[model samples]
Target: MTTTAHTPPAETPPAQAREQFRAGLRRPTSGYSPGYAQVNLIAVPQAQAFDMLLFAQRNPKSCPVLGVLEAGQYSSELLSGGDIRTDIPAYRVYRDGELVAEPDEVTDYWRADLVAFLIGCSFTFEAPMLEAGLPVAHIDQRVNVPMYVTGTDCAPAGSISGPLVVSMRPLPPDRIADAVRITSRYPGVHGAPIHIGNPEELGIRDINSPDFGDPVEIPEGWIPVFWACGVTPQAAVMQSAPELAISHAPGHMLVTDLPNDQLQVP
Candidate 1:
């Protein structure tokens, strides 16, 4: 007998929020998501939104926020068709520096006291970098970009505070300058490299092992370059442990109504 498998619609589902989130995460649409701007997500209590937005402004490099949602509203009028509660494929729920569960959907956890934040991710910036002939080791090797919780301190906002997180790329000496020039034009998505040579200076002890994502080959003639990452905010939210918090699973960004090219400063 041929058995039929059930599949859920792309829209947010009322039941099995965690399952829905997992379904969205099965694959990364990334460039293929088509016409949608990818976004980083952070869910926090309504009381913390003001302080968090202030933190984002103070640390633009690490927390380039794209949109903010008032308590109890999942739809983002600012991003146009952006739905905070269901747009993304996956979300991680944390309590006091510990990740308790990563639900596929968060509707059950949605609260009147919660505020949603859409921050910028480095994934969009990689599009231009690849177009410019810069090598993104992760994509080339079919691995994730290595993310590290650096010793660098973020500008604190009330109870939210943590070390800055960074994503690394190894580039040939010939391409480093071009990489800087292209990325600098898109400051909203992590602008440029924070470190170019030694990872130790940033308090990264091991180059091969990373706190998050997979490490790539550092071939001869190529030096490691690092950029501030959107994960910085999630880390802060996790550390704060404000009774409840949620964020997109790393790399599974919310596809938005905005265009990626618009991130560039004309």
Candidate 2:
């Protein structure tokens, strides 16, 4: 029941666009939905939601969950007045293991048997990282974090399996250990870097051209550090290809009611 904005506005203020996007379900969400928790969105048929939710629980570092909606329900009441069907800016539609479409809204594909999921994203942890004087490359470059399909395997669920996907950030070798420690405290948002160096070991052939997102420049004194990304679910969904699936498009994220500070494990 929501209208989609396929073409991003050329001159709208970031805050206004973010609000409009929050009103629909857009990922890679821009501007700070100030004070709101931005989440990764995933939707599957009723039959798979359970297994997917379990997969998320099993892989908490990669899929830290904030909430899940019941089948046929669009509202993520637990996370707030978020309407899963429309709050995200864009969504990927899947069929039989292939990406069929990326739409601004999924109202047309709405199904009575669908369930929605809202998982935590690194955006929450980046706030602390910046505050701690650590730099986030993607933020500095104004682009989505570069992600790659790694050689690491995820703990699998029924018919759902794939290599772990990681988002890369360049860090000074000296600050590497601290970045790991600081991010580890927020396990709910991909707590720490999985691999700190050598993209080749992760099956990534070219660091300049990542599998997803634009590459950021790696300067003289920095090393490429990677974190488990929220996009893993989308990749898994595409690979598994259950009938009639929907997910937030890369970068567009679900804005939730939880505070970013709450993601930290005391």
Candidate 3:
């Protein structure tokens, strides 16, 4: 397995982070360059672009589309020359919607008909959350945020539809309001908590066992807060079973030139 067991230092710039991934450093990108924004990646055949776009439109919270690249184009104008095929620390290749391999790079999977979509990531709000004195468990623990498939279904668009997915962070009951206030400012990044408290309410049978990413322990008096996640699109793709699709492995996002503050709304 291609493992993201190590990451570039927090002081590393976005370009250098990309360089590390390009050099085969496969590590989860939770705290790399704190102020920079990170994005979830999804590349699919151009033939399915319209449906994918429509899907994002219908399910904006879970699939907030940041930008979409032209077929076969790997660079994004929004991300400052970052190559989609090599900039992310890890990539997952899905054939007929089933994940086939988790690789450090996807140059061999590149094709002329593939169009890449950059989606907003929840990691974008962590810097602000931390600044506000709230604890983000995954970052403190150095693990991927725990994610789960929810019972709620996303609004369907063409052939793209699936259960909503969420990332969980355990927050103290008293600080939940502050966490909400801070994160709600960044709607572009899957802002705010979609659910709070009981995990079973969201069809998550085992809070310790997430559908994707790593699990974190809930400290005493803390409640499990859920946020709509970019991984939702990958779940939708798997259900729709597109011929081929590629996504940033959970927690391994595409770091961009855009600052996190730029994504904040009034």
Candidate 4:
């Protein structure tokens, strides 16, 4: 269910990964398929689809649009034969911005008027970070990445407005520059570190406690590095309270056929 990538796990194809998720395997998807891209999911009703798209455009750092499925559509070229309703590790169902249920599969909650947005996730760059000898704390500790709801407000769009959320990984002082360099190359996936040393500057009072996912251990002298999170859209969903919304459970991502290298820049 969890992996420490000191010795990387055998690669699993995106189709095979989706089959496992469809069959009810539920866990954080990091380090599962080393080279393939992973995406965060947020699906809302057809009526508010334009507003949601606008919200993403306004907050590109946290909501980089990867590939979107049409209103009522469930499958896309991203996952190659995967169904959006069942291919993720878990789902969160929200009604008017209230979290009502979290289930392994969301086929029962699927709506014909729903439009799904697949946003790029920072997990897309984790493999590259590891390859560069920069340790990923959550993966090593075998836990979901810690995410904090910061005091900084995101640029609002219509009814969708919320606080900025960030994912954290502790890195040694020496490797901080390398981590920044590696992630900056993949701008589509949350990009580089937004806040490097002080969590207080980001309005995060405590580093140990996170609003979402599990808290990771930060070794002495290792600073917490923050990245714009895909979960930020879910934060907006909670605050804005749309009629109906569905999203991936934090840390549970949808593995896609797209390779990680395709997103890297020279």
Best by lDDT: 4
Taking the tens digit of each residue's C-alpha lDDT, what string does model 2 give over 108-194?
888988888787787777777778899888777676667787778888888676668888889989999989999899888888888
lDDT of 4: 0.90
Badly placed stretches (over 4 Å) of model 1 are 1-25, 34-36, 77-82
The sequence of per-residue lDDT tens digits that candidate 1 reaches over residues 154-250 is 9998878888999899999999999989888878888888889899999999989977666678889899999998889888976776777888777
Prediction 2 global C-alpha lDDT: 0.75
lDDT of 2 at 42: 80
- For each candidate in turn, the TM-score is 0.87, 0.88, 0.96, 0.96
* Tens-place lDDT digits, model 4, residues 130-163: 8898999988887888999999999998878999
Sort by lDDT, best first: what order?
A: 4, 3, 2, 1
lDDT of each: 0.74, 0.75, 0.88, 0.90
Candidate closer to the true structure by TM-score (higher is better), 3 or 4? 3
- Candidate ranking under TM-score, highest first, comes to 3, 4, 2, 1
Clashing pairs in model 4?
none
- Lowest lDDT block of 10, candidate 4: 1-10
Q: How many clashes (backbone atoms < 3 Å, residues ≥3 apart in a chain or on different chains) does model 2 have?
A: 17
Clash numbers, per candidate: 5, 17, 2, 0
Q: Write the per-residue lDDT of candidate 3 for residues 19-133, one digit (tens) a residue.
A: 8888888788888888888999888898888998899989888888888998967786666767888888889999999999898899998898998889999999998888889
For all predictions, the C-alpha RMSD in Å is 6.0, 4.3, 1.4, 2.3
- Predict model 3's lDDT versus the native: 0.88
Model 1 Cα shift for residue 221 (angstroms):
2.2
